[model samples]
Target chain A: MSNFINQILQSEKTLAFPIMTHPGIEALGKTVREAVSDGEIHYQAIKYISEHFDTIACTSIMDLTVEAEAFGAIINLPEHEVPSVTGRLVNDLKSVGSLEVPTLDKGRIPQYLLANKLAAENIRSKPVFSGCIGPFSLAGRLYDMSEILMDIYIEPDVVNQLLEKCTEFLVNYCRALKATGTTGVIIAEPAAGLLSDDDCMMYSTVFVKQIVDAVQDDNFTVILHNCGNTGHCTNAMIASGARALHFGNAINMEDVLKQCPENVVVIGNLNPVGVFKQGTESSVRKATQKLMTETAGYKNFVISSGCDLPPFVPEENIRVFLETVKSNNV
Target chain B: MSSELLTKLSECVEFGKINLASPYPPQMKGLPGADEITKEALESGVTPGEILNDALISAMNKVGQKFSENKIFVPQMLLSAKAMGASMIHLKPFFANGSVQRKGVFILGTVFGDLHDIGKNLFGMMVEGAGWEVIDLGIDVKIEKFVEAVKQNPTAVVGISALLTTTMVNMKPVIEAIKAISPDTKVIVGGAPLSSDFAAQIGADGYGKNPQEGIVWLDKLTA
Candidate 1:
């Protein structure tokens, strides 16, 4: 692993979702979704965020949609809120085959790539892990989610073809990301969590392994995130060869962490919504401390939000979370 | 023969056999499905109430319980829901003719600023299968819209869902506004972001971890 990966391995820290958007919505007086589309604002937000928490990530705002939008999926962008994929672009084998993988400049991808490069060049102390969606998740966005699940059973060849194309684009995207002097990439495949372990292995894990092999090494690590799996497919997720694993609030973090290889890093899974954005300061601190106590035995464990913390999460709550982690070092 | 029809209809729903034309489940391929059996029941002089309470609701309850217990999943529950919907098509006319009754109405939606609806749709379908008239407001519904829906539906139990942490906080206000206008309207809350503790904290009447649990709550509420 790279020195950055090696460093994170040495120390326990609180790493989480978009800090720029959290402050952008609360302090900067701009909509985070809109701000993230602009690389300069995204960099500034990360810079502003770095002062608060070390080992912060580049703006992971809507990492789920960039690939789908690039593949010509219609996106519904609301000014002050998260963007969503509106219509499915792939319906059948012909449609999946007709999909043309767009260049790096397609949609708002370059902005994210730019933000990663800028953050890496500026922030010299800690790691700047960039975020991207995984192949199964990107494919799920391009087609109907439920249909894709059923299709995996009935139309395996078509789904595999779509996954191949998705993985091809992701491999290219990760290569471009690695060239940007970033520390690592977190490939989020939350949609694959909805599948059975066998299906997840066949469809999600194998495809993610291809990307991991292509992009990851001792110099650059791959962190696999599956908020959807809820520990049901934890074994399949670990087998993807991602150096780090991040889970969601659907399953207990302590239990999930136990399933990880002893050497691998485990990050998770405070309730980003119920406990972070919506919780009071005392409650946030209590939840974080409780989680720390629960997972205290796992030295490989790193405390993090179960998923991305939403915008306008009270600055106080954020402070308590960071402080709770810092004060209670294992 | 009549009891046999009811058992067959229930079996069709329980097994998620949509129709004779549906080729799913492999072994049940060529057999008549929920739609075919429900129609046969009606023609053979089975009452709509018996068909609903005995076969349809029973089948859905088993599905719901299985879902809660992790015996089946979303895809399977959805298949069962599609089968139930197919049967409901033939039975809907009986309600208009005053031969059948509904349990009560259920008003549900994903709260404002949240666009996710797959969970809401499933819950609505399950509640509908349980013999309640479900008024789904769809996603990104404002609190005023919820209040207005409560005003219109009056006695209907309200359910609110939010998939995001930001939008889940909005569930509190929707619950507040609906209760502010109609205190008797029991408001239920659920989502990936919400917990029973949060639901109780927000003054909601109950919380459903899954759609089946929501139906169980609604059944107890109207019971």
Candidate 2:
């Protein structure tokens, strides 16, 4: 039986699995023996995930700074690391007035589109997720964080104005990526958790609702991902119109499961460093077993890390997670 | 602002009022937010040290407690921080003159291979709000930078954050490096990939489940 199917059978004692790795794809080099090096790192991520596990996707590191870069912010692309913006786009609130929704073809948008297209072809029959930076996170990237927060108070109108444009860009980008044949899109909104419940409803949820509403369809699903403590914003995320939610390690998986609507799927609560990066395979397997048992019998759950996998995590541990799950099949 | 006004300003901060002109919770809109009250206290002859200690520090302590309990979200805490920041602007001269005392120093950064920092930044701000002087190293930080920071600060607490699973592993050696240099320096670890067990394994002195928890741990260490 497939390891993934065995996991579904609920007989596995362990269920640790590796999260996607973006840079590892680049390490494959240009050798023909490494057939995985067919396209960008994101596509290679899809191929790698599909070959090893039940699900397939990239965490979208084509450059975390892509949108910010396109927004005319100065970006620092270190040779060995993912790109980041050095400063904010709206250094002054006056700059926000000039900003507009960028074309999807601009910046690294083409890279995502192409990656999604390739993932669609390589990850046949498996769920392929294309991720986009949610409006608020992108806004922080475009504008320096300090300035953004200051603007939130001194010029909320400008913040709102920028949010609308950012939302438009993200929605269009999500739709375009979805059209590339992805099963879903993961909206990475690490910044939304920073808002109060009302602000979440007003700024975060309001914009996200518009995006989800604009992208509604059976062909694609929206998975909300916030890599911050999101317990306060979980309901707001649900209200924002996502079908699933992915959270950081700080969140209580049990609490999230209990609080979220029954139909809302929950993926992950693994200690990425504790188990996947540092612990032994046995430890990882045990943790997965514990997690599965903790939230047992709920179809709304998927075994995943609390967040993205660390690059140096041993692949053997991942193999062990799959093996343990497969071995447990009833 | 008189000492009495400073005391009142602190109350405004403790409850989270951005400025005297703002009305968030609606009860204190026109009465005076942290901004106006703090300024008023300063003008009314309140010493900067009194404002920093009695008003700003005390208010942030309440904000931190509320945050740890989940009674507040990022926006509320941020508002409190903003209020604190606005008030701190007036106290900068006092710090320069040695009239106000900062608790200690903290050097914070996201671990290598991790690109996310919203959590890391929030923790830095919160720690700063708690009266510690913070030197933010920003995201995708390397181990050497931390070593250098520890070398400079000597007694400064080192904090490492990583929001990505892929990047969290890099923290292990970073933590080890700090201990190698200054074993006495407290090492606090947080982020999405870490937990208490992981923190223990990494030999970190403490692990915060959230930014507020980090501040609490730091305060306890200094206390």
Candidate 3:
């Protein structure tokens, strides 16, 4: 296990590791587009958030589009919103064979790498984790999410071919992120959560495990983040051998904790939208305390937003969330 | 023979056997799939309504129930939908000639600023399979477009979807606009970020946690 995981496991206090960074654009006076596209702005946003919040680690923007964009997928960059892949790039087996594995220099990757490098250098107090879209999620973006889901059954070999290329690219990408002095990379595989447990094991877990094995060591870690899982594929996720598991708010954290091994750090599952972006300060406090109390018996539980905090999540709500977690320290 | 064909067709739809050539489900290999079975049922003098009600609708309901119970996930549900679509091709002519009647019209869309449509499309397919005429407006649907769709199909139930927390807030105005144009029109809202409380807060007539729940609400409306 990495020292990062060891520290989290040994800590008595419930740690806060919300997948946050976008809201720091509020202080930077920058739009979402500017922050995502520019390295300095992205670094500054992470810096600002880490300085303000007492988090165990600082995470980069959980933008799922950056790696897809690097793979030559057309991205829709909204000025104030997280970007999305507008359409698919590959549709057939021939195209999958022809798809190129991009280098770190491709499409805003350098910018993201620079952001993480800067965060690693500057944020000395806490571990800095860079974020990337997981292999299956990136492949889904390249082949279209709906189309790929059906393709998994219709053309298993073709989907496997595409997944091989995706896994290859991600292994290299995570290696590059590791070279940037960051502590680890959080592979966001929300797309795989749409699969049944067996299918998830076949198409997602196998590839994620490959990446986990390729880049993870004592000095670095792999944290698997799946916001789309509804409790069906927790075993598949655990089998990936990631050092930590991060969940979204779609399932009950207590149930997931029961399925998880006590030594592996299990982080997550406060509703980022319902309780943070849309709820009142009192609601944030109540939700945080409720989650903490529900999983209070588990030593490995970490209190966090179920997913990345959206751009306009109220600052007061975030403040209340942190304060509540701190005040109710186990 | 006709009843056997209908049973076979329903099994094809439930198991996602698209056609004879499809290699899925491993055990069902070399047998006819939904496409061929549906055609054989029609040629053997099975009524179109029987094929639809007994095969397509019955199979899709099982798919929905399995989905709601987590016995299956999206990939399996979508394959079942594809199989149903194959059978529906044989039944479309009957609907056009008024030999068969649909339950009602359901107008669906993902609200503006949200491009996610996996949920919307799945629900649309399920509704279509359940004998409802579905007018899917696609993603990033503006409020005016929804109001216009409601204006055309005034009695139709409106189902709006938004997958993002940031975009789900957009559901409020779209629901309000549809209600303004047709107050009696029932509007249902769904998405990852939505809740029953959020649906009521936004004046939605109902909230569907999944496509099956949405179908249940739609069935209750006409029942």
Candidate 4:
């Protein structure tokens, strides 16, 4: 096991850390309205988390929006918050045709690469996983969803063409991030679960396979995380070549583990809001214990939230998560 | 249409037989599906109300109830909704002509800062199946958009879904915005990172832990 995973196992409590540091902006940490003001503030946030937690993860908030924004999608940034694209991509497939592969130096993508490196280097050996958005999610952000959905019938060719572009950008971005020396990558695929089995196989799986295949190296783990109830796509997700699949707790854990490939690690399923965000520390500990027991003797697994830990989640709850894992060793 | 025909229609819906063109659920492959059955009922002088009540609505209700009890999930509910939608098109004229009345009105969206929408989409279809007219504002809906929706449709119940904790906080403003526009408009919230207490704390009128719960609450309000 990696030292980071060992610390989690050795800790007397449930171990918890964030995936990204808030450099003010959701991505890049540049001045996009509510950006992190400057790099110093972002550094302080990292320092604070590292000083307190057993581990620290990089903070790259808007990694998902970078490629879409570069692709002529008008992204609006609310002051001190993450940026969001203005409209769905279906309104103008022609515009996507004009889109270029985003260079690392051009937009916030490079800064995220920097942030991950800094977090990894600063935290030294503490595990720092770079959370990247899925191709489908970035495509959803770039275009109008209603149009893309309709294109599934009226103009599947157009949808395929656009997805091709998205896949290119996503693969390139993942490759660039992988080159940066971050411990691993977490591909967030919230939109993949929205599609039917056929649509998911066609639209999501191929791109995911490309990214995972492109980023895999002996040094880093490429984790794929999808939030919400993904009971239907569990098997397909494992087949997408992700080393680990992080999904929400709403799904039956046993069912998911059963579908997982032996080499594929399973992470996550804590109810982020309901249990971690709302419950007391003891309850969080108990929940973590239950998850650990369920996965007893499973070598390739990690305890984590079914999704992102809500920012306002209680610190004590995090401690309990680490404690539960420690107190109950497999 | 004969009672036997209606029964077949209900079965198609229960089994999620969308249209003649679909070949899913292999047992029903090459068989007449929801589309053919609904169109046949219309041609046979079946009242839209009977086809809707005895066939489409009942099947969807069963799906919704089953989902509430965890017997089925999003994919099944989605298929059932597709079947219901196929039948609904045949009854559109009835709705337009006021021969058939929708149960109520619902306004739903994913809150700002959250772009995820599977939950919202599921809720929209499930609630629509439960007999309400749904106005989906879509994802990343701002507080102003919600306020405008509430102002434009004063009687519509509001629903907000957020998958991110950062975005779930936005639900509060949407609920407050709707309340500010029309306090009488009921507001319900759900998402991965939300709880009933969070919903209540945000001043929402109700909280649905799942899509089916949202339907049950909407049904109660309309009833």
| Per-residue lDDT of candidate 3, residues B23-51 (tens digit) | 87678988899999888888989999999
Order the numbered candidates by TM-score, best leading: 3, 1, 2, 4
lDDT of 2 by residue, B81-163 (tens): 77777787777787778877899999999898666676777788788778888899988789999999999999899999986
Q: For model 4, what is the alpha-carbon lDDT of residue B72? A: 62
- What DockQ would you assign to candidate 4? 0.25
Per-residue lDDT of A1-330 in model 3, one digit per residue for the tens? 789988888888898988899779878899999999998999999999989988899998889999899999999898888999988899998999899988879999999999999998898888899999988899999998988999898888989999998899899989989999999999999999999989999999999999999999999989999988999999999999998999999989999999999878899999988898889998898899999989997888888999999889888898899999899983
lDDT of 3 at A55: 87
Per-chain TM-score (chain B), model 2: 0.90
Interface C-alpha root-mean-square deviation of candidate 1? 2.3
For model 1, residues A288-322, the per-residue Cα lDDT tens digits are 89988898767677778777777677877878888
**lDDT, candidate 2, residue B129?**
79
Candidate topping DockQ:
3
Quality class of the docking in candidate 1, CAPRI style: acceptable
Candidate 2: misplaced stretches above 4 Å?
A1-41, A56-63, A78-81, A91-93, A146-154, B1-4, B18-26, B30-36, B42-45, B105-125, B128-184, B196-203
Question: Each model's interface RMSD (Å)?
Answer: 2.3, 3.8, 1.1, 5.5
| Reference A-B contact fraction recovered by candidate 1 | 0.25
Please tell me how candidate 2 rates in CAPRI terms: acceptable
Model 1 error, position A185 (Å): 1.2
C-alpha lDDT of residue A309 in model 2: 63
What is the clash count for each candidate, in the order shown? 2, 20, 0, 23
Residue-level lDDT of model 2, residues A1-330, one tens digit each, is 222232333433333323465324534442221222234666775576666654334444434566766677776544434456775567555778788778876766677688788887666756667777788878878876655754565568888888888998888887888788777777878777776666667767888888888875666677777756557777788898777778776677888889877666677777666777677988988987777677866666666777666455677776666665566533
Off by over 4 Å in 3: none
